[model samples]
Target: MRRLILLRHAKSDRPLGIVDLDRPLNDRGKRAAPQMGAYLAAEGLIPEAVVVSPAKRTRETWEAIQSALTGPEAEVVPSIYEAPEAALLSIVQTTPDTAGSLLMIGHNPGLQDLAMRLAGSGEKAGRKRLSLEFPTAAVVVLDFEGDAWSTVAAGTGRLERFVAPRDIKIGD
Candidate 1:
């Protein structure tokens, strides 16, 4: 089985004169990213390989997540930034076979749409929640019944869980 982790970029600041691609994560995002990383460590959802979008906010989110837990081999893929579902799927198909699990930190509604499109079944409540919105700093863990990433197709993955910042508890 191959596990895929889809993480939406955390909240970001819309600074005047800065382009959207260069916006940095806001304070809340800084907090949420680490908390989400903690959740991943607690749940043992670490990936063997991570593919990240090259946007500033997404990169900052990865840095914050890394501060909490570090293991996965990551790379910056320029195509991931603001890509649509089809484009994202193309990226997934090209994943190396050596990596058992893959993680992607990117934007939405590409991530959201991809997650929804790929998931055929899973936790009922989580599926319902996912259909609504993929909030910033949210994550969706999906399991596909294939050894090769190239074999994954639409409506083929089982949605293991859907988690968001609000669902996590940060210690005081």
Candidate 2:
């Protein structure tokens, strides 16, 4: 089976003077990013490969999470910065098969839309919550039946888990 972890970029500072891609993570994002990472590590859900958007917020989120993981290397996908659901799926479908567990840190509504489209079924509450809103720093885990990334397709994944920073206490 192949596991897909879709992580939306953490909360970011508003883009006033800075360009959208250059906006850094806000204080809440900085705290939530590490918390999410620790939660994943504690659950033994580490990914083999991480694909991230080139945006500063996404890159920073990956950096914060990297410390909690063992050896997952990250690749910057410029297209992910503004990609739609279809484009995002293309990137995932092209991932090397050797990467059994894959994590993608990017933006939305692409990430949110992708998760909604790919997930066939799972925990009813989780699916319902995901359908509402994919908040910043939310992590959605989906499990596909096949062993290869190339086999991934819409409505083929089973939602494994869904977590938002609010679901976790930072110091706990």
* Root-mean-square deviation of every model: 1.2, 1.0
lDDT of 2 by residue, 50-146 (tens): 9999999999999998999895689999989989999999999999999999999999999999999999989989989998999999999999998
Q: lDDT scores for all predictions?
A: 0.91, 0.93
lDDT of 1: 0.91
Please list the residue runs of candidate 2 whose C-alpha ends up more than 4 Å from where it truly belongs after superposition. Answer: none
Candidate 2: residue 158 lDDT (0-100): 97
Q: What residue pairs clash in candidate 2, if any at all?
A: none
Candidate 2 to truth, TM: 0.97
Clashes of 1: 0
Q: Model 2, residue 153: what's the lDDT?
A: 93
Weakest ten-residue segment in model 2 by summed lDDT: 163-172
Worst 10 residues of 1 by lDDT: 65-74
How well does candidate 1 match the true structure in TM-score terms?
Answer: 0.96
